[model samples]
Target: MKEMILMTPGPTMVPEEVKKVAGAQPLHHRTEEFYELFSNLNKNLKEIFKTKNEVITLTSSGTGGMEAVIANLFSTGDKVLVASIGYFGERFYDIAKAYGLDAELQDFGWGNAVDPNVLEDKLRNGNYKALLVTHNETSTGVTNNVKEIAKIADRYGVAVIVDAVSSLGGIPLEMDEWGIDAVITCSQKCLMSPPGLSFVALSERAWKMAETSNLPKYYFNLKKAREGVLKPNPDTPATPAVSTIMAVAKATNMLLEFGLDNVYKRQATYGKRVREYVKSLGLELLPEEDIASDLITAIKVPEKYKASEIINHMKEKHGVLITGGQGPLKGKIIRIGHMGYVTEEMLTKTLEALKDAIKE
Candidate 1:
């Protein structure tokens, strides 16, 4: 079999150490051994999230984490503003509306970042219970200025809910320092783990909202998850993904060992390398440099080339896997993910494959 490289934004290439843990014998979730692992997992997760808040783990997709936050923190008829820049941002809006929140979407263009000034104006003028923002707009490869946006929300006394699914572990996000009430992320992206686990951290203010929230929820109940984590023997409300959790526990430790700052700088370096090489090939990046994400790069596919055709060629001819745009930009742009355990050598090979694919 040909060696295949995954350069897509999610389910990123896993480190060998994490894969080793995942391959270990599955432990019973109710055992003391698992509890000890769970305890350590939660502690490391808090450090990555940069918050002192109790981080809740759920055995579901990142979207489930988003839903958990919306369902637990707000009631029906609660008005909230969703600052949408790309696909994931729009998902936050969709989730909010699905739960019967009066969701007002403050939409910016796909490849652009949310202007804090505009967000502040909305907060000052609009009647909102909370503000929902995507820390990284993965679709457009744009990273929002969460620190600035959080400051604006804080000034207006509006609760802030951040969808940090693609940004939390890959980048620096000081949730407590930014005054964000809640932030949700998954294990697959920068956490260097596989799918099936999503994490949500709640500040003191978010916990207060959960206490008063009248929204009906059962499986994704934050309170229950919190209680489970706080017990003498840590566990989950449902049978969690035992093996996946074990893998994530290992991945988290590896990330800390490398040092968070070093990880961020490494990802930045990879992104820059990809961007410069792609531009040298006469390709245009989707997002402006100021708002570009260090974890993913979205580039406009040349007009004559179909994104799908190029993607197919790259896979079949070179055994390299990348992704095309989502939503409206589909077939118009290609997204190259540099997050997780990706290396410069891997990216160099991907670029070579891309150049070959384009030529052929």
Candidate 2:
């Protein structure tokens, strides 16, 4: 089998050591062995999230965790402000609507970041229930100033929920310190694990809301998950993804071993290379430099040709799979993912192939 380097925003390359660890003897989910695994994962993820809150493990994707927040926190006819700067941000609105909540969206152009001032203005006097936003808009490669948004939401007595699926591990998110109530992350993106698990870090305020929330939630019930985690048995009510949990356990250990600070630095270093390489191709950067997310870099297409050609050539010819922009900016931008178990060498190699592809 030919090994191709994955440069897509999600499902980034997994380390061989992690693969080896995951392939090791599987453990039963009901035993003390699984308890130790869950406990370690919970503790380590708290460190990564920079939170003291309980980290709930969900057996679905990031969207499942997002739905969990909506189902458990919003009541019927409750109003929520969804920040829409990219595809992920728009999903919050969709989630709100699916749960029968009143959703107000603050729309921005793709490849743009959500302005903190806009959030403050919308949250100031509105009878809103919660503020939902994406920490990093993976589709456009823009990182929103969630800390500032959290501050605004805090001032208005509104809970702040973040879709941090793509940004959690690669970027720095101090959930508790930033006043984020519920933050959702996925296993495949920056977590360096296969896609099977979703993680949520919830503040005490969010937990309190879950207790009184009138949404009909059973499988994704937040209170039940918390109860399970606190129980003496340390088992969730549902049968957890045992094999994937094993993979996450090893990956989290590797992340801690590398040190969070060092891990972020690696992303930043590779991101810089990506920016320089893309600029060398006479293309522009998507997000503003200071506010760009280190997880992935979205490069603007040159005015000469269409971005579709580039995506096709890079994938079919070079076996270098990259992602086109999502939502409104599709075919106008292509993103290169530098997040998770990646090095400068990997980025340089991708850039070299991209250079040839564009030139041809």
Candidate 3:
């Protein structure tokens, strides 16, 4: 098989140390040894999120963590104002309705940020139980205006749940400073590790609601996770992702060693480089320049060509890998992730391959 370089937004090129750690042997969840791992995991997760709150680690991917947040913090008929900007945002609404929540979706066009004025107006109505939104809408490579949304949610006394799945470490996230009640993320994406580990940074307010929200919950319950994660022994309600946790420890430590400021700067700079390169290629960008995500850049495919054709050419001919758009934007956009192990060389090579592939 041809060795490939993964440039997709998710399951990004994992670091060598991360892959090494992921190969470590598993352990029993109830043991003190495991608890020790869990303790460190929670501590560093807090550091990465730039929060004082404890983080709940789930055995599943980011979706499981999102679902747990919905189940434990919201109940049937509870009014929720959700911001829909991309594929993941739609899933938030889907979860809300599936669990019987009164979901009022406020939509922004794909690749566009939600209007803060509109959110403020909606919150002024003062009728929501919670305000749920994604910090970085992964599907569209657009980062939402989370701080503004948090301010709006606070004015209404509605609990705020943010899906930081792609923004946590790659971006500077001040959960408490922004007044975010619940911010959930995944190990994949900008964390620069493999999937199967989903984390939630919780405010005291979020936990209070989780304790008495009367929502049915089990394995992924935040309160239960808090108990296990806080103890000296690290364990989950289900079997923990031992390898993933080990990989996370390395990944987080690497982030700190590199210094978060540097990491975030690199993310921003790398993305800007790609965006500039894409534009020079005569292609349009999807998200507004100021609102684009540092984790990935979504470039509009030309009308004369198919996005998949270019993607296949890059993969088969140039050994480069990127992603096509999801949902309505499919076949019209190509996503290039500059996060994780991505280097300037990779972007340059990928761009060269893209140029070659698009040559008529």
Instruction: List the candidates' TM-scores in order.
Output: 0.98, 0.96, 0.96
From the highest lDDT down, the ranking of the candidates is 1, 2, 3
Computed on alpha carbons, the lDDT of every model, listed in order, comes to 0.92, 0.85, 0.85
Model 3 error, position 307 (Å) = 0.7
Q: Measured by TM-score, how close is model 1 to the native structure? A: 0.98
Error of 1 at 81 (Å): 0.1
Question: Per-residue lDDT of 1-360 in model 2, one digit per residue for the tens?
Answer: 677789988788888877786778877878998998888888888898899877889999999999999998878888999988888888889989988999998987677888777778888878798989998888888888888888888898999999999988787888988889999998999889888889888899888888778989999987889888887667778998877788888898889898888888888888777887788788899888987778888988877878888878887777778888777788788888888878666776789889988789
Which candidate, 2 or 3, has the higher lDDT? 2
lDDT by residue for model 3 (1-360), tens = 976888887888888888888887766667777677667767788888878878888878888989989998876788998988999899999998989999998998898898998888898895898888988876788998888888888888988899988888888789989999888899988788899888888888887777777778878677877776665455676778787887887888888888889988988888888889888888999998999988888989989999999999999998999999999999989988777777777878888988898884
Clash count of each predicted structure:
0, 0, 4
Residue 231, candidate 2: Cα error in Å is 2.2
Error of 2 at 189 (Å): 0.9
Top of the candidates by TM-score: 1
